[model samples]
Target: MSNRSRPDSAGSPRGSDEAAQGPGVSAGTAPVGTVLVVLHQARSTPGRIGARLQRRGYGLDVRRPALGEDLPQTLDGHCGVVVFGGPMSANDPHPFLREETVLLERALARSVPTLGVCLGAQLMARALGARVDGHREGVCEIGYYPLEATPAGAALLPWPDHVYHWHSEGFDLPEGAELLATGRTFPHQAFRYGMNGYGLQFHPEVTREMMAAWTERGAHRLTHPGAQPAEAHFSGFDRHDGAVCRWLDAFLDAWLAAAPLK
Candidate 1:
C-alpha cells in the first residue's frame, strides 16, 4: 500500500491523527503510516519536519517523554522516527532522558529510519558510547553557522552552506559512525550510524515562527560567546532559508529511502 493509504496503527495516538490530517486530508480518509515523533517540551511542535512528513503522506505519532508519556517498546508499528531539539542536555540524569537513549538504541539496532536533531543527536551519540558536552571555551551556536559536508555527505545529498543552530552542547562522532558534516565550532555537525540512523546537530526543522519563538524565549542564550544577536538570526534566515528548505526536502527523501543495515 502507498504510504498515505496505510491504516493508522496503535502506535499513533488520536491527537496525533488529527494533527497529522491538518487541512489537506479529508475527514473520512484512512490515516497514513505513522512516524514516531519524540519531542522534549509539552508545547514543542515538530515544525517543518512534521509538515514535511505529512506532505509525504506520513502521519506523526508525537510523544513528549519529558511530560510523562511513554515511548514505544519497539518501532515495528512505525515507518520512521524523529527526535527533535530542546533546551535539555542529553547528559542530564532525568529518567526520561535515559528512556529516550534506550529508544534510540533500539531504533538504530533495528535499522529503522531514525533521525535525531540537536539534543536528540547528542542522545544518539551517547547511546553509541560517545561523549556529549559543551565547548571548554564556553561558546554556543545559537544562530546560523557554516556547514561543510564531508565527501560521504556530498555523495549522498547537497547541503546548505549555513544552517540554523540553537544548542550549547555538541557530540563526538560515535564509533562505527561515518561523519557526514562538520563545522568549526562543533566539528561533528552530522553523522550517520549504519544505513538508517542519522543525527544532525543543527535545526533544519525550525520554521520562521519557531525561530522567532526560540530567539525570544531563549533571549538570554544570545549573550553567550559565539552566539549571534537576535537581529542577526532574522537576517540570516532571510538570507539562507531557501537553501535550507531545499536541502531538507532532498535530505528527507534520501532518509526515507535508506535501507535497513544488513
Candidate 2:
C-alpha cells in the first residue's frame, strides 16, 4: 500500500487490531487500514482532520508528491483521501500534482471520500473538469477572509460567515459539481461533488502552530514586521473547526464504511 504503511484503530495501539478482534473481525475491518494524505505543499499540516480521525480510529499514509515520493495505492480499503494546502500552483508545470488529481477523479468515480484544502481544492476542481486560473484576483489573499455558504453549502458544510484564505488562484465551478461557498474575490471558496467529496480553498487544517509556521516561512513575502503589524492576521479564525470538520468527518465516515478491502 505504501513504502511504509500499517494500520490499527487510531485510538488503539498500532498492532492491537488483529489481537483484539478475536479472529472475528469481518471483511470490513481490515487490521492494516489507512487514509491517503496528499501533501500539496511544504507547510500544510493535518491539524483537526488528524485529530478527529484519530478519535474515530483511522491512520494515515502520507503522500508527498512535491517531495518526489510516489502516491500510495488507491483509496480502496483506505478511510479516505485528504489533499492539503501548498504554495505551488496545480497548473504550474507539474505532473505529480495533476497525477494526484487524476487519482482523485478515480476516488470520485468510486464515491470515495475526499477533502481538498486550498491548492488542494483547486486541483480537485481541475480534476473534476473545472477551469482554474490565478488571473481573477491577481493578488495574493494572505489571511482570514469571509465566506458565504450557498443553500447547498449550508446543507453540506454549515460554514460560518467567514473562513481563511491563503491562495491567489481560484476556479470556475466544474460541471456536475455544486458550489458550496464563496467570497468577495473568489466564487469558488468551496465545492462538493456528490456526498463524499469536498473542495475548500481555505486552510481549515491550520492550527495555531501551523499558522505560525506558515507566517514565519512566508515572512519574506510580507513587507511590514511588527506586533499586530498591518500583515499578520489570525485573529479572525473564530473557532469554525466544528463546522469544518463535522462535514468532513461525515464524508469520511460514510464513504469509508463502504470502502472495499483488498
Q: Which model scores highest in lDDT?
A: 1
Model 1: pairs clashing at backbone N, Cα or C within 3 Å:
none
Q: Per-residue CA lDDT of candidate 2, range 17-71, in tens?
A: 2211223224566434467877644334466665555555566667778778888
- Please give the clash total of every predicted structure, in order: 0, 1
- Candidate of highest TM-score: 1
Tens digits of per-residue lDDT for model 1, 31-133 = 4677899987655677777877877777778899978999998788887889877667788788998999999998888788889988889889999999988
Worst 10 residues of 2 by lDDT: 1-10
Off by over 4 Å in 1: 1-25, 260-262
TM-scores for all predictions = 0.89, 0.76
Show where candidate 2 strays beyond 4 Å: 1-33, 41-44, 223-232, 238-262
The C-alpha RMSD of each candidate to the native structure, in angstroms, is 7.6, 8.3
